[model samples]
Target chain A: MNTKELVEQIYKKKSFLCIGLDVDLNKVPKHLLKLDDPIFEFNKAIIDATQHLAVAYKPNIAFYEAYGIKGWKSLEKTITYLNTNYPEVFTIADAKRGDIGNTSTMYAKAFFEDLQFDSITVAPYMGKDSVEPFLSFEDKHTILLALTSNQGAFDFQTKKIEGKELYKNVIEISKSYHNAQNLMYVVGATKAEYLSEIRGIIPDSFLLVPGVGAQGGNLQEVCKYGINDQVGLLINSSRGIIYASDAEDYAQAAANKALELQKQMEEILLFKK
Target chain B: MNTKELVEQIYKKKSFLCIGLDVDLNKVPKHLLKLDDPIFEFNKAIIDATQHLAVAYKPNIAFYEAYGIKGWKSLEKTITYLNTNYPEVFTIADAKRGDIGNTSTMYAKAFFEDLQFDSITVAPYMGKDSVEPFLSFEDKHTILLALTSNQGAFDFQTKKIEGKELYKNVIEISKSYHNAQNLMYVVGATKAEYLSEIRGIIPDSFLLVPGVGAQGGNLQEVCKYGINDQVGLLINSSRGIIYASDAEDYAQAAANKALELQKQMEEILLFKK
Candidate 1:
């Protein structure tokens, strides 16, 4: 799906929201454990509760892969559930997978073909061959990790390459690659201050942002700098939303948290309009 | 096992051979496809055939993961076969997973604890917090992707961060994180020319060299520049070995390929001493 179409839907719905399904087994509602598949149970409730308010749902694959086969099945169930019930919601496999050319092609098939995720997160360390294969999918999107919110982000991301932050250079040079429009980036909300600068470099591209809620990133600041003419942001809150409470009513609590973010996002979109 | 002890074993065996099990479903033998679990059958035969000739057996997760639940089960069976039958043979998940702090911890658990891989490949783009989680596991190794052999590897890797190549800086800085001693790097053999430069930064650490066979990496060039005093190289060949022949003789062809690499590696190890 073209990002402009997503933005158009966002404006029509008056919400610029994305709910992150980073379901952790230990942290999920204890009552849900009684179900045969706790991960799918937890995700279904959250998706049912918040689907109307969100434009997308980002599922971090590590959470599912942790439980091994059972976890992956739960992931498949969750995606199938979404497709069957909430097909309008965009799906992102937050799997930071990158490798040699042939290997990367298999990964593209894993997410895009086997799992049917709308987008997949990729690391740009291996350069064009590793990432271009992912971007080649005419209908799919590749979310490259540019500047993250982690402490080690400063380790090499900000390193100056020819008088520019390595990340800045990455965005500039990555633009030159063929089929660049399919490439978005991950700019963490905790590092929202860099959004103004990031937007200045690549103004039109969408950003799949994490670190908004439990990480204590102020949503307003991220919207202020990260939003574009099309309202280009998918703010993800994992712990803050999905783990809102461990009580039996955790789903509703998650819905409440999602509603809070959705309301704020609506206001931002209104302001932009 | 300590890195030095592992190196000693490789030296005594006169081989730094790591047979790569990047199994392609289509390349699997037709006879095995009749088995209840074809991929597992294929992997078991290959592992059994070449376990002695190789010091390590790296099963790239993508090939198996592309098959969905069956693929994951195949991966589990592959690792289980490796651990149960040949425990001394080091196992690598070849899953380049890295994310934020808590997420990274879960990924570390997925591969290292849950699956019990001796090592897991990690992408270093998210910085130290993402990578440190993987390194924190006791005795388990985390092989970070360094200079890869693909065209895109030049995209962000060779970009000078503060006037030094990003790959070099990643090695230099990652060397200082907690439990960094358990760290290794994935330096593709196709990029063998830069191996000496990589070794200069982290001379004593192990390098998991891929891209040798089907990817056109020269083994001689890799050994000449990449090998250190410790004989610390785990050169991997996937398609060249595992998929050498797609017929019933596939595993036998795999054994021959592994033997060829081992023979060459033995000569290199002797020449170095």
Candidate 2:
């Protein structure tokens, strides 16, 4: 989906929330396990319950990959269902993939062409050529890692490079690449204060902010500093929303959690207006 | 495979040549396309032909992942073939993967538990927690990206951080993580001059050196500076060796290319001995 369409969806839904499908068998409802494809079934139920509450869905690729071929099949099914049923919602493959040019092209093909995700997370460690392949795809987004939520983010990302944080340099340098317009960024909500500094670098680019609920990032603080004219922020919530309950009303409980976020987002959008 | 087994294999084969199974349908022989699983058929043929010449095989995961489910199935089959037939040859999943702690654990399970590769490449962008889970696995090696061969390596890796190169800091810092003994590094062959400086930091850890023939890296130069007491270098050749020919005798031609590398490796090991 184009930036305009994504913005329109945010306005239409009153939320820029992106639900994370980081499914783990141990975390899902016990009753779902009896189903033939529990992962897909769990995702299907969650989507059914909360598709309207969010404008995007980011499926962490590792969750599916851990299950092997069976996991891959479930991923394929989940994506197909999303595309078929709710084509308006933007889909992001939280895969964190990047490599040398030719190898990266294959990855672009894997996520963009084959699995058909609207966007994929890319690690900027490999630099220009590693990231440009994904950017080259028409209408597809490449969410580059800026400042992640993990404690590990401080280890290298925030380190001073040329007297500025490496991530700041990443945001600055990446802008001059082949198709910089297609780029979005992964800026963790835990570092909500940094978002103001980050916005100064790439004011227009959408930032996929994870770490809102389970990771203890304040949504109000994130929106206070992260909001743009086009609602250029995709706040993601995973475990706190999806694993809200393990009973038969698991999907309903997920919707309730999603509704809470969506309601907060609605107020944030109202304040912006 | 343990460190001792890997070192023994390098000595036994007299070659640390790592053949890259980066299969592309367009590059393989036309006849192979007739098979039910062309990628697997090609990999099988190449493995059958060159199992004796090379001490290791590094299958670039992107090539297989590009084809979607079929690609993953081919990857499963290729790794299965390698483990079943040539159990002695060390396998590296050239999947440069790393994520949050829990997500990273899932990736470890994907490549190490399900895929069963001896080692897997990891990007250091996420730092310690992202890397430790992979290293936690017994006997499994994590080949961290330090100084990549691509032009992009100069983009951030060579930049100054605390008066030292970022990649240098990566090497120095990674050593302090848990199971640092299980860590290896990916140092591009293109920067052979930097290998001397890298060796000064961690002399014992293995270095998986790519960019040999097609990327124009010289094998002799990489060995001159990068080699350790354990013959701690796995020189990878992908396009130059795997896609040696596009005709009916493609596998045979690939073997011939691999033989040339194995011969060069043997000479390097002989001098070391």
Candidate 3:
């Protein structure tokens, strides 16, 4: 899906919430464990329950990869299901993959062509050549890691390079990449104070913010500085929503949690209007 | 495998030559393409032919991940083959993966536990929390990307951070991680001039050096500054070794190419002695 369509969906659903499918079997409901593919089942249930309250589903690739071939199978099934059942809801691979030029091309093919994710998160440490391969793909988005939500983001990202923060350098440099219009960015909601400055660098680009609720990032603070005229912010909630309740009503419980966030997003959008 | 064991294997084999199994179907021999699992078959042939010459095998994960499920299956079979048959040889999953603390644990599990690689390459952009989890794994090495072989390395890696290069800061900061002993680093052969300074920082840590032949890195030049008492370098040549020929003699051709590098490595070890 294109940026225009994503914005359309956000307005249509009255939400810019992106549910994170970082499914770990240990955390899922005990009853779902008996199923043939528990991971896919859990994701299916969550998507069904909260698809309306969200415009995107971001799957943390590490969770699926930890399970090996079985995990890859589940991932394939999940992507296929999302594309077939609800194509309108954007899909983010959240793979955080980047490599040398040729190798990065292989990764782009894996996530964008084969798995068919609308976008995949990429690390910017390898610099231009490592990231540009993903940008070359028409219509497919590449969410570059500008300033992550994690504590580690301070390690190298916030450090000064040429008298400017590395994250800002990344945002500034990436704008010049080939077909850079397809570029989006991963900015942590935990660092909401940094958003206005980040917005100053790339005011129009979408930022997939992943830190709220469980990570102690306030939604109001994030929206206060994050949202643009097109509402270019995807506030992701994983553990706070998915693992809400492990009982049979786990899906409903997840929906309730999502409803709370969606209602707040709705109010924010209305107030902005 | 531990550092001691890896060093022992390097000395015993008289070659720290790391064969990169970056098997792209388009580049492989036509005959192998007829096989059910061409990727695995190609890898097995190459491993069988060069097992005695090379001390380690580094399969670039992006190559496998490109093929999706079947590719993962091929990777599984190839690794299983390497472990079972050539148990003495060290394995490196050139995945170049890193994430937040919890997610890093999942990636460490995927490569170290699930994939059972002796070492896995990780990107250091996220800093301490993103990398320490990989270090926590006993006997499993975390090869951090310090200076990559690609041109993009010059983009941010060489940039001064607080009057010191970011790559140097990465090496310095990573040393203070949880289990610093388990940390190796990826210092590309293309950047041989940076080796002495890198060696000054982490003399004992193993450096997986790619860009030997295909990317125009000199093994002799690399050995002059990069080698330690244990000959702390795994010189990787992917296309120059693996894709030596696309005819029926592909395996033999690959072995011949690996032997040339192995011979060069042997000379380096002998000269060092």
TM-score of chain B of each: 0.97, 0.99, 0.98
Residue B131's lDDT in candidate 1: 91
**Clashes, model 3:** 0
lDDT of the candidates, in the order given? 0.86, 0.94, 0.92
Candidate 1 CAPRI level: high
Give stretches of model 1 more than 4 Å off.
Answer: none
Worst 10 residues of 3 chain A by lDDT: A146-155
Question: In what order do the candidates fall by lDDT, top score first?
Answer: 2, 3, 1
Chain A accuracy as TM-score for every candidate: 0.97, 0.99, 0.99
Tens digits of per-residue lDDT for model 2, A148-256:
9999999999999979999999999999999899999999999999999999998899999999999999999999999999989999999998999988899999999
DockQ of the candidate models in sequence: 0.84, 0.87, 0.84
iRMS for model 3?
A: 0.8
Task: Write model 2 residue lDDT over B1-273, tens digit each, in one string.
Answer: 998999999888888999999999999999989999999999999999998999889999999889988989999999999999999999999999999999999999999999999999999998999999999999999999999999998889999998999999999999999999999999999999999999999999999999999998999999999999998999999899888899989889999999888898888888887
lDDT-better candidate, 2 vs 3: 2
Error at B228, model 3, angstroms: 1.0
Q: Which TM-score value belongs to model 1?
A: 0.97
Docking class of 3: high
Which lDDT tens digits does candidate 1 get at residues A188-216? Answer: 88888899999988999999888787777
